[model samples]
Target: MAIEIYGIKNCDTMKKARAWLDAAGIEYRLHDYKVEGADPDRLKQWAGVVGWEKLLNRAGTTFRKLPEDDRAVADADGAIALMVAHPSLIKRPVVEYDGGVLVGFSGDKWDEMLR
Candidate 1:
């Protein structure tokens, strides 16, 4: 079951998710967007599965600090562009497993799907 976790390495949510995966004995790879940068193609793919709305992290400080026009995105394309430009705008710890993609961290949901 190829599982890849994506997020900023220093994010608290990323730390918690990594700890959970480690404790669960789950083998996975970390795709730290802060270091490697986000891919437009991959962002588009994730958006397709979960909807750009769910992938975009409007509540995060990065989004909050964006220009008003950037935050006023009206569609997936707009959101994707924003995310690609600012990877921090995407929700943290997006896990992509063999079955599907999971956006954000929720212990119950992670256990149900990842465990």
Candidate 2:
């Protein structure tokens, strides 16, 4: 399957990642969280692979704005629940490529994997 990238369509980081994919002539399909809602089961699977720490976008405004009770998630289940309810809490451009997955984008890393 072609690599599938998940992120908000207008996210700056997502824009950068999309640019790299386009410039590299790579085939990919964007799964915009805004347009297509996230699945809790899929989110859980991603968390299982990369860990909830990597999947959660703690640096984003959405996460920062969360109430203490929501932010005080104690486990993967809590994190995943929040991520599902607030898709913006998800780190941008989670790429499902080949048989593996990449949680964020980097030019060098993309080059390495695509190569």
Candidate 3:
């Protein structure tokens, strides 16, 4: 199975997820958005599968720090633009695995999907 995890290297959640994968002995690749940046096409694709609402990290500091107008995005395009411009605006550790994509880190969910 092809599993790619995307997140910033220094993010706390990213660290937890990486540690979990390490303990589980799951082989995967880390797409550190902070260093590598995000692909607009890929962001759009994730938005399609999970809906832009789920992909957007409204809880994160990056999104919270955005201008009020930017935060009031009423459509996927608006959210996508923000996320593409600032990858941190997207949720942490988006895992693309087993023909599907998942955003955020949850041990149960990761095990369910990967195992």
Candidate 4:
């Protein structure tokens, strides 16, 4: 299966996801959005699948630091713009495998999806 993992390298969740993939002998590409920068088009695509609310990390420091107006309301377009400008506002470790997209990892979920 073709798998691509997108997230910042320093995030604890991303670290654990990477370790899980490695130990499972899964070959995947890691797209570090912090380094490569998030593409607005790609963010929109993900939003379509999971919805912007699920894709945006409201609990993160980046989101908390945004101006009240910026965080007041976010649709797909608005969320994509914000994520493009500040990738840290995105939820951690979005994994795209074959025809599936997984956001946020759980041990059981990873085992079921990758095993």
Please report the TM-score between candidate 1 and the true structure.
Answer: 0.97
Clashes of 4: 0
Which model is ahead, 1 or 3, in terms of lDDT?
1
Candidate 2 lDDT, 4-114, residue by residue in tens: 999999999999999999899998999999999888999999989999999998988898899989988889999989999999999988999887789888899888886
Cα distance off (Å), candidate 1, residue 56: 0.4
The TM-score measured for candidate 4 stands at 0.95
Q: Which ranges of candidate 1 are over 4 A from the true structure? A: none
lDDT rank, highest first? 1, 3, 2, 4
User: lDDT of each structure?
Assistant: 0.93, 0.90, 0.91, 0.89
Which 10 consecutive residues of model 2 have the lowest summed lDDT? 106-115
Which one is best on lDDT?
A: 1
Model 3 local distance difference test score: 0.91
lDDT of 1 by residue, 1-115 (tens): 7899999999999999999999999999999997899999999999899999999999988998989988899999999888988999999989999889999999999999988
Worst 10 residues of 4 by lDDT: 72-81
Q: Please provide TM-scores, in order, for all candidate models, with all chains considered together.
A: 0.97, 0.96, 0.96, 0.95
RMSD of each: 0.7, 1.0, 0.9, 0.9
* lDDT (10s digit) by residue, model 4, range 1-115: 9999999999999999999999999999999997999989888888888888988999999989999999986478888888899999889889998777889978799889867
- Check candidate 1 and list the clashing pairs: none
Candidate 1 Cα lDDT to native: 0.93
How does residue 21 of candidate 1 score in lDDT? 96
lDDT of 2: 0.90
Candidate 3 lDDT by residue in tens digits, 1-115 = 8889998999999999999999999988999987899998999999999999999989978888989999999898888899889999889989999889988999999888887
